[model samples]
Target: MRNLLLSPFTLPPPSGQTRNCGVTEVLCEACDHLGWKKPTKIQIEAIPVALEGRDVIGLAETGSGKTGAFALPILQSLLASAQRLHSLILTPTRELAFQIAEQFEALGSSIGVKTAVIVGGIDTMSQALVLAKKPHVVIATPGRLIDHLENTKGFNLRALKFLVMDEADRILNMDFESEVDKILKVIPRERRTFLFSATMTKKVQKLQRAALQDPVKCAVSTKYATVDKLQQYYIFIPSKYKDCYLVSILNELAGNSFMVFCGTCNNAQRVALMLRNLGITAIPLHGQMSQNKRLGALNKFKSKSRSVLLATDVASRGLDIPHVDCVINFDIPTHSKDYIHRVGRTARAGRSGKSITFVTQYDVELFQRIEALIGKKLPAFPTQEEEVMMLVERVSEAQRFARIEMKESTEKRKRPKAGEEAADDGEQSSGVRKKVKGGSFRGRSKRGR
Candidate 1:
């Protein structure tokens, strides 16, 4: 039976069906212009309640259009009064903050709703300047917003009308509890609050109790679930020849866009470098990169200039990248919940996609935990041993090139250059596994039964 419970929603085909959520005519026209013909499931449930002036706790997975759920209502409220510095949206990461700001601008463009993003890696003085202008909406990371609240002259959220904590679980997971508390202390206690998260962990529950006032629970997915359209599979192989297998799969699946998740920032950079050397368009996005570079990488991948994006968990949550045909878990996540978020990058918005996880001998235990969490036994991904072995020579060559480039990049860390991977905080060096290559590529592999 289909899940009757609220779940990460699927977008319906663009039909003559209208998306009238009692939003103003201008907002309706804006939604139409943005091609949001019908709101996703989370939006359908959350928007109406929010329009009724109720606080909401939105439990929706990635790609469920939770942004629209909160955004449309906030804009509608702004329409009624047009209060300056009307809303404050706090996210765990800078990328998500910018994406929220982008949606706000799009949906509220006709009404001229100005938004400012406050996050680290960009100059604080610049962000302070933006705040001084008193934009109608401010989307920020907790840490950075805290910095401004404590340090910036004459900037505060005392009169903020709407407060949204997007990815509340992640924000608390990232140890921003104190920062969040500090923010809550400063904002008006009587304002409407929205807490949106994929999983309502205990920490999130505590936060909701503190932040919202008898909030309507607009839950889409409280379970650890993947989309029904996602085709899940795994490959069992020895750890040594992972690069060979990766190259083999990419060649076989040429023309499809991919997100290859690595365990560390350094590994993501190395994998992207290796893929580029072998004539694949790949880009790396991780925490070590500066804010500008991170956004640049995302834009390149989104614009389809890069066919594969090598990323750590930083790109996993709340980044709505389009046309991602597959997700390759190059390194299996130690935590099972992350596996859900990682693969959620693909098969979004009712589109069918595939996820192939590389289950090395060392990763079997971790991979098993993920299968158990998602409540399914994944079939093995099909692979030809001979085909993978044939890629050994070229893959080894690219590996050498990548290692040399990594060493050179490390030495040149003092000067940030165009196309240079920024120096990671010791985590990058740890991710590139050392292995003997060349004359022998010894590894066990299994094809799908």
Candidate 2:
């Protein structure tokens, strides 16, 4: 038997370098330059498989370094291939496309791999010109890429060898399936494909079947994966008192950057206004906002200058935000998957964070569904005395309003005397009947007739 002897001058590689060191060292070094310190479990597991040139389907909670998992490997492959044109990454949204492109630029600065970003909000001419330089990688939104492919005469993907669908579920949800299928028809059948998503819905599965060739599937967390670093809690409050409870919680928090998720743009705006009125720097992000405004709000939030961002589900998916210490659910999501993505904004990249959902009586069923999906009960946070008092006041106010409405309704049903019309108008002066206005005017007319 022959035994291999170790050389005294040779030393073993550091952590993540041994294949066992995982993504820690690479992330540590990357973060040292980009100022990140940790890699989430998704990144740790998926990166290795991706680097092995295997098609990977990664399922993890959002903000779990899922982007970096596929991105790092793509960057490394590009460098190793040393080809000017080898890979193309397709995302569902312009924001995500730009985000992925930025990450690639940050990680591939030393390697000098030219990368191009193509999205709808920007002009396609510039993108075409960028591609003319023969970039090694192209990150683009599906719709924008299709537009370029059809309109740009010189644009081509003949040299493309790697294709990645980042946030595959969202892409399918956005109705980009046809566009993706068309693009696939253009790309070489032998090219490698990677599909990444937070949750693997049926549509995503179908896409995986069509794109991936004997892919390596990786799930860092369970189906409804919750990060251990996030301290999840729920507060049961009536709908009327949600604002009051949110204000109290904001008052108590130690000024960490937080994101509040709402189900609609109107709700997000309302929450943002209420927070601003309470002296909190809150911004709103939703599809209604123009691309520039959305970018501005994201930039401000990322700058850490703003303490709170109120956003809808559209903003929830594919947003690679950093340093968000907290996530508040102003409205419990109707979709269980959305709830996971909302809270996943925090506890990102292995950072400790807290998520407090303002669950109201009406949201009980929805909250229960979320818990069932996650396979765990969400603990409740005891409302502060002030918050409770605020709730009591709200309940009292609601009762008073209910009583008033009932009284008015009962009075409306009863026949009224001509002279009594003055009373309904809230004026009992000089026996003069001043006709009420709008709805009340009709009631006054009924009495007069």
Candidate 3:
């Protein structure tokens, strides 16, 4: 259990250490292209072990560069033995799977590496085609991968060289144990394996025994803690005034991007619409949305076209957005660990950030649990009650418009056109539509203005 809290300035040289770990020349060049000047703590610890063709269990927090810890070694090995579908990386969420695939592609771009992202809510035939061609690496979610493994013909990982379970704890928590068991039976036993997780739960420990052989443990942080650079605080208010408090905070901290986390998709959508009506550039990303829309929202936020992103826990883990200056826990997570993941979205890669959690009367116990888990007593985020009350009128009007927009969106979904409903087969339903329900256009209407 090494202390990973050392400042980057005082950290040992990563380039010299990575070279000593047998990292290939092409991989180093790729790191340079991606502007990776030095490896993070997780990478410094796990990469060498993985390069030796040994099973590794990486225990580190989110935004710790775990992808490169595994992807680099896998790509280095792939360079030695050119093969399609050489490796498989499993993740809990579709967004994480796509993000990992993007990293693989960026790292292996010079070597002409081909990677395919197989996740649910997308066309099966298109993924099947990609599988038939047999990309160099296959990054997927467990359920969708099992769907392909069982249903799609001529799609098996017979010669897979590496197996990676990224965010193993979340995968098991999402109830993908059966799918993982099925995958294990199909893939070869005599292969390298890597299990990376933020927290090592009992299920993860059990999974380690079932999945790995003589694994080396590389733990950077043995306890639950947030980054030192993160400034965490809470706002205490009545439950009815939560929205007003959020508006006050956003207005107070204007010009900085925010990731506002809600507890449900409906709430996330409502809040995004509410913010949009008040001239805030906010977007929503939830599990219920189509894959293309989810990616579109993420891209918009990443490209700075949107300043605030309202989302559920789906965006909490493994989807890195480096420009997030603040994380507002609009709805306090019931699980304390989730609070860590949500706030981890900001203060990434040595950059300082802020996290403000809203604590209502109903959320007292949850907030206490989060404090206990993180081993700190958070101070209150300063707010002027008068200033917050001043915005109540505008916020109430926006709430009314948001409710109308939500009702209309629900009606549209329920009353799809006759042909559209009939033609909604499995394949056609997965495609991205030009028009999205409850889109930003509704926020710019006359009433919203």
Candidate 4:
């Protein structure tokens, strides 16, 4: 059923002043200090309902601060209870899990609420020991949590009262369906569930049915939701020449800091190498990398030591890197869902940002599919003169082949005589001059003379 609780919010210019509202007095004061003035459209509508301890399904964009919408309510709920780890959060990626835990810690720190993050790249024993301390909230990735649940003796979620699935679409994509199912089975049935995503499909709906009881669906944006803070641009180029084009664009831009999205790990690696060879700081982040390396790479990027990040769709979900001015789609994503996730990396937290997509003939279909899914046209940016010139300079001669000139042999050689055809037909005997039997009786001798 459609949730029609509030009048549809037509976004007004965000006032720079913080306002008192649904969140706790401390949270509101924190928002004031942080300049989180008005509740974002999603936060305004979803927070009150969520604070009432109802099951919530928040459909909003990545940068909409949906984290606060759910995090605030969870924090409020925890204030009334002294029990340890009354809430559980399941995130799709380690980076996201870390992000969630960090937010929870920041908000709950004043209240003395303890939180623990469990993900793969870190030591399992450390997580086990932390859980042994009985954290009030456990933030985990589905896989490692299952490993902990199955192996760690005496681990229990029977007392858990709240559960959140952040980026439900991403969790479902990485084949975490079975793991999530197992987690649901172990946790008690009398728990409040919240599922948040940018787009909702049948899979999310089914998961919601299994996990939530009479969920109050709150959709803040449609698939085509446009964030006016973000400026979108597209450039069409060929596949083989994309790397050089990207390098040229990077050099042209003043800020070297960028997050580039590629369709695959191999492509991401290739782009990273090209950028690095040009003395541009670049790193590749993808599913194939070890979690330790992934975390290390993310740290480097966060520290501003690495200016360019080349990544697959894996980087698109749940990871938060602040102060990113631009996001580039180095290759158009085949999946429409990924397109939203990729661009969402920039324009975060109400910061104005830009996203540019590189489209080649091969990516045209993918681009169209995304447009169809999002129900909006991605604005096309005119190719600058420099980009066109770069394209022309990089074009292969073979592909633009033009027949030119040929010259006859330069070295002087004895020409065969018309009547010496018979002599030429026979093989040379033992590499000798053969004298040609008196110069083949006459004509060959005249030519030699």
Candidate 5:
């Protein structure tokens, strides 16, 4: 068995290298169906190594085609010998779990791959029923998977052949160390393991030691690197005038699609409502939302029905939406590393894009840290103070309505009906927006502010 420890390699995969990476004819047809014309650098390096039946530690950032790298090898192996409860893929978030399952199903459709997503924000009994069937692949979050392992009857991973930990750095960052450790103990020690992450944190290093055995390292881009086509800028403004600046920028870049990142769930929701009040087509996706609602919001953004997506950190890493043309950091991230992931939502697939980070007076130190980490000072996004100030009155009204809606939504949750529990978290947000101001406003992003 030859060891492959690839260093940082440039894009545009080597000629005929990706095609010869050991995928069977069936999986090759599936890749062509998905329009995967050329494999990414990570895929070029990691897939062949993974196909060799060795443990793998892949180091790559989001949008680097890491999913295909891991998915194809596992699917190919599954086709060689069909088995139930064969592979277990763990992700840090529910969105990523579903995404991995999608890719697996799409790529393995010819081979009839059945996957189950085990995560929070859905019915446990339903998941238990799915697990009772013993799916071909299990994609899950660490905590929820442990819950089923302990509580759910007739469910276990003893026969699992593959164990994958995607976003291992974030899984540990989310305080899932004990759960991951518990899961590592329960699964078979004889199975193959795959660990992928953007950063090699200390916790990740420890996890690699415990969970993997003599894994090959596939490092693509480890530094704090942003895409060269991404035009990054920052705006220094007063804390109280953030909404005004945001409205001004949206007005300036009216037609371009955007992903606006906020600091918290409530802020994401509030910003969504405020933008809607100002006649912008915006949707919010946060951890506080129900699974269906979160998926609904994501679908809305993906289909281009909504022009702006307001999201928290949960939407930052690993979930790919290819149409976003700009990113706005409405609230600067406390962790400088998050800035990289946030801006990554755009400038994907070699398309030019832009990102604007809002730097309030109180965020100077934090902004400086981001600049230092990225190794460059970003230009200030040009803005007209008079135009921003001119929108203050209207923006203030929108803010007031957002605050009221947030309070009402909170109170509604405190007194949710038995059947309307899911509706408590922004279900009525769309209809509720139309009711504001006698339904005179049009929630469309193409319109100028």
Candidate 6:
């Protein structure tokens, strides 16, 4: 972790501010419209270098305005060149691709910059049509972009001017290395490239060498650290009493929104059902759910229709949902790097937030690894044993119902059919607990089950 304050790529005092970042008049107006008062650290450093027509490797944490660091320069260049499909931004996830497209549209609205989001789990024909029309910016996941490039007719990146790989580490982690290689081979080599990531792993460094030419590294955080405003704590509890502790935390922190992270999709769904049964407005967002349902859960949480969002790592990185008051780690992440990303969901944009991680006996080593990675020890979140016990009866009842619901849901998924909705409802109305195959009432338990 090198000191970024004295990095050679730092912008001069005069142009470090957003108003003097060398963007054109129209873009400045657009920034004003977006209510961006000044440039973030990453933007201040990387934007100036990008505006100078230099390939940039930006290292910044999540919610550090990394998008603006690349977007402003691309938008400025687009204003001058005025070509369709001039820039292409690659992300690791479908949701991130859509979020980047929205930011591009918002920033370039005054200039009428048309953009298209190309990702999986959607209509391909519509994306093909969008590609044919030639949008100003095309934001896509690497795999889907490769699919379109190999299949879509009359579509290519021979004339591309700017290429961006946002969340470059996650892109490689998701096994998009070969797809990225194919994209790099097809796109013009003369284009300017920007690789932005929170951490600089060996893969990212290798990709930077292969994809960028004489890139300037603008790193904002030299070490892994949470935002100053985030109050982080942990709780060590018995595995059996995890649900009770979670219920206590939610009740204690009532009136604020929360994003509770679980390690598995099944556990996320189970916890959501359990919380709902306990009269909490909670929704589940994970990989197993359909794309529409995942987006619905996200929308419900974002619009304040739901106060708690139970999700897996799918919502960990690159999805910016503002107004999240706290992030509860219902299940500690296996990888320490993921901890940074999970807590990052809150304490964004200069707002204060809290993060409470659950550390069972088996998670001591993993929790210590996280503390070492972040270079700090976390204090325990205070909890009263008697109060947690008071909620056990209700939580136990909800747990029973959650198990039944999970069983039925698994059965529904396994035996997919039309017109079975009514029959499923009738079975639920009868409230009979038929013995499901596999084991006792609890089918798949949490980790260590």
Query: Which is the leading candidate under TM-score?
Result: 5
Query: In candidate 5, what residue range of length 10 has the lowest lDDT sum?
Result: 1-10
lDDT of 1: 0.84
Tens digits of per-residue lDDT for model 1, 192-262: 99999988899999998888898999888868899999999999998989998998888788889999999
Against the unseen true structure, what C-alpha lDDT does each candidate score? 0.84, 0.71, 0.85, 0.72, 0.84, 0.83
List the candidate numbers ranked by TM-score, top first. Answer: 5, 3, 6, 1, 4, 2
- 159-231: candidate 3 lDDT, tens digit per residue: 9999999999999999999999999999999999999999999999999999899999999999988998999
Put down candidate 5 lDDT per residue, 82-172, tens digits, no spaces. Answer: 7789999999999999989999988877667789999998899999999998888999999999999999998989988999999889999
lDDT of 1 at 334: 90
Task: Encode model 4's per-residue lDDT on 1-449: one tens digit a residue.
Answer: 11112222222222332353356676665566555777887887777777667899999988888888888877666654456768899988888888888787776665666789999878889889999988878999999999999998788898898999999988998899999999999999999999998888788989998999887888888764546788888878877777656766776674647999988875675555444433466787877666766777788888998888888887898676777778999888877778777888888877887888899988788888877876777787655656545533323321121111000110111343455321211111112222211212112231121
Residue pairs with backbone overlap in model 1: 6-220, 7-220
CA lDDT for candidate 5:
0.84
lDDT of 6 by residue, 223-311 (tens): 88889999999999998999999989998888899999999988988888777666677788888776667777788888999899998
What does the lDDT come to for candidate 3? 0.85
What's the residue-level lDDT of 350 in candidate 2?
61
How far off is residue 43 in model 4, in Å? 1.3
lDDT of 2: 0.71
What TM-score, to 2 decimals, does candidate 5 have? 0.91
Q: Please report the candidate that would top lDDT against the real structure.
A: 3
My TM-score estimates for the predictions, one after another, are 0.89, 0.78, 0.90, 0.80, 0.91, 0.89
For model 2, residues 1-449, the per-residue Cα lDDT tens digits are 11111111222333645443234344346656986555567776777677667889888778777767776776555534466568899887777777888888777665565789887767668778897887878998888888988988778898788898888888888899899899999988888888888888899999888888999998876567777888999998888777667767776775688898988876675556444433456787777665666777788889987788888887777786778888999888888888887888887666789999888879989988888988898889877765456444433433343344335534643756664431221112122122212112112222121
